[model samples]
Target: MAEPILKWAGGKRQLLDELYARFPASYGRYHEPFVGGGALFFDLEPADAAINDANPRLIGFYERVRDEPEALIERLEAFDDPDADPDPSLPYHEETARGRDVESYYYQQRARFNRRPYEGAFDPLEEAALLLYLNRTCYNGLYRENADGGFNVPAGRYANPDWVQRDRIRRASDVLAEAAIRNDDFAYVLDAADPGDLVYFDPPYEPMSATASFNEYSADGFDREDQRRLLDVASELDEAGVRVVLSNSGVMYEPYADAGFRVETEDATRAINSDPDSRDAVDEIVATNVPPEDRGSAGQRELSGF
Candidate 1:
């Protein structure tokens, strides 16, 4: 089954075509070092692929979907009725808004999320439902943490945001079932790559402009050192004949170019910060190891069955 198309923050659904255009006609296997949303993974539909993330909960959700898709689907489908009332019984809003002692509050919500019955707590079918819920309903969809390593984002503005994409989740699970899911630091997956493997890196953007940064995807911040390490990995992969595509804030391309990667820039608009004022245009870059000759000359390229 084809992977379901999902709407997720940092998802590359919009750039799938553009990224695919740069991929070679064929590759031995696919690898994603930081598979945040799995947008590119599902889009490419590689027969054999390795998808890894540092977030254990996120990866566990993916594994659950793959192993018990029916249960997950049933949980998500319960939210489908248009007239269903939002679960106001929960104190997620009040607890999240009073952010003074946010760590406790955030974990309380996480505990609530983890403890609820399959129907009330979380829907198994829509693996994305919990992700989307925490993303939209939580502080800023900004997966952040306090000094103690607890999620600390405040509640968001969406009163009853739609949290389930039943069919899409099913599809995404289908795709995930065939791929290997790993929960580890990015290096472990990158090191596992073989010659001709394709790796796509979507690390947190290094905030360039005053208003254009969101480097706090996890409690452990991805700093400049991490960025440099990623570049080094890309270089090592290139030397090993592995194709690498990296997306990041456009400001870092000069360093990447210095590392011998061919950099291509594009303008991208995203709604990131919870504030409406923060949702504006931004420039992003796609640095690649694929040879220029192999890239599509025109529109987005389709690389799945190539």
Candidate 2:
């Protein structure tokens, strides 16, 4: 099975088992346009897949793993001493904040990540490690940034964090080797689907309440315009006979109802965030263009199991 490459803010790791139960027992090829944590991709282990994300760094990491897993592993191994302090405030922190040199910025970010309360600069590999490290250690594993694309989240309180999951990384690398990883706009992926292809989308949730919506997957946010574009894409894919399953905020269903799709609401609890008040269970939607035979089975199974 594949593991998630990044510790994403709103990853679907908890939903994978239930979601897979609803998928067609057999399908042609698997495609994940918004491949955040890739919980589903890893869990399903599809033979043919086109996994993609809008985050360039994420795509770069996956590509590197496919071509140079050992190198990435070595870098990760260097961070194994979780208690070792490496200076949290590095030069790249200021550089990234200023939108100066991104490569140098990332390197510095990694050094800070290695040292709790970071204090020095880092290299590219270390930066990647820091990214993963912060994701694992931050509040709810959420990755939020300022308008300028700098990493701005504060550290979380974890007594012990799995700084390096060597086995999981190796497994993830093996799983990714068989898939094609791409860094592109989500439409590029949706448009590439052929008939019989299965596409799973987990876009940023449309906010249910004014305070609930957050879209930091990329430096630029996915605004209402992006949502409309995604709905249009769903229409196109539905017409082409491609299986499409989506997860988003329940609030979006009212607007998306005209797209000829089915919508179901599920209860979800927030796992990443600093405030305990924001951790309560809330309603989320599962929208899909798949036929009835291919939908809702997993929901039923989950309810039955509970």
Candidate 3:
């Protein structure tokens, strides 16, 4: 199986079992609008699928991964030299190591990435490489943005940061080859999905609490309105007889229960919290119209006990 290439903020690796149990045995096609780490999409490796993200750069990165895996791999390998000079003075993995400052390198690349020639001119390959590198080295593997649309996540502490995985990249390329990748609003899935297809909406979730929010994946964070819009879309899909599954914060999504979707909560391990101490497990809402017969038994079994 192909693993997720990037360590995304709301990546669903921890919730894979729960998501999997809710998946239909089979469907006409697969649709994932908020393809972050794309944990479930990559796992299913569906032949006819459409994966999308609100972030254009993220979609561009996926394009590069699919179309130029070898070139991306070559560029990513050059970044493997974490700290060559060995600044024996700094503590191990603390800010600076070897003589080179890892944090400095991260910020420098971020500046380069934000520095567009004009408004939107950029080299896709380079941006993709920088995006991947920054995500791997950033705090909590988050790709956050500032109000000015700049990549602003601070550098993380990693003794030996490894962001280059040749086999994984190649595997992902194979999986994406047959899929239609797009950069668009989540609602685009509505026009593209058919009745028998499966649509999974893992939109940026509402925060568990004030201290637990990390929704700034873009300049304008996904707020209450976006959550409501997503619910509407999911409800539409459900009514169309499309298999609909959605995941969001446990707190604000009780409204989904009123929408007639089966709303359930499961403990999901989340690491993207401002307070490191609180980055443990939290209840996450998983609403779906998938029938119990269509869903696999294992995830239901594990979640029932959980």
TM-score of every prediction relative to native: 0.77, 0.81, 0.87
User: Candidate 2: worst 10 consecutive residues by lDDT?
Assistant: 297-306
Instruction: For candidate 3, give the lDDT.
Output: 0.78
Which stretch of 10 consecutive residues in model 1 shows the poorest summed lDDT?
97-106
**Residue 272 CA displacement from its true place in model 3, Å:** 2.8
Which ranking of candidates, highest lDDT first? 3, 2, 1
Candidate achieving the largest TM-score: 3
Question: Among all windows of ten consecutive residues in candidate 3, which has the lowest summed lDDT?
Answer: 297-306
Tens-digit lDDT string for candidate 1 (212-239): 5565556576887888887777888889
Per-residue CA lDDT of candidate 2, range 1-306, in tens? 456666666667656654665566556788898887776777667789999888766676676667666776776655533334333443444343334433333334443543322333335555566667666655556777656555666555567766566666778778887898888888986568988788898888777787766787667888888888988888788888888888887788776566778777777776565786877776777777666676544332111110
What candidate 1 gets wrong by more than 4 Å, as runs, is 1-7, 76-132, 139-142, 210-212, 296-306
C-alpha-based local distance difference test score of model 1: 0.65
Estimate, for each residue in 26-95, the C-alpha lDDT of model 3 and write its tens digit.
7888999999877778777888999999887889899999999999999888764433432334232333
Query: What residue pairs clash in candidate 1, if any at all?
Result: 4-171, 4-172, 72-124, 72-125, 73-125, 139-154
Scored against the true structure, residue 182 in model 3 reaches a CA lDDT of 93
What lDDT does the true structure give each of the candidates? 0.65, 0.67, 0.78
Candidate 2 TM-score to native? 0.81
Angstrom error at residue 95, model 2: 9.7
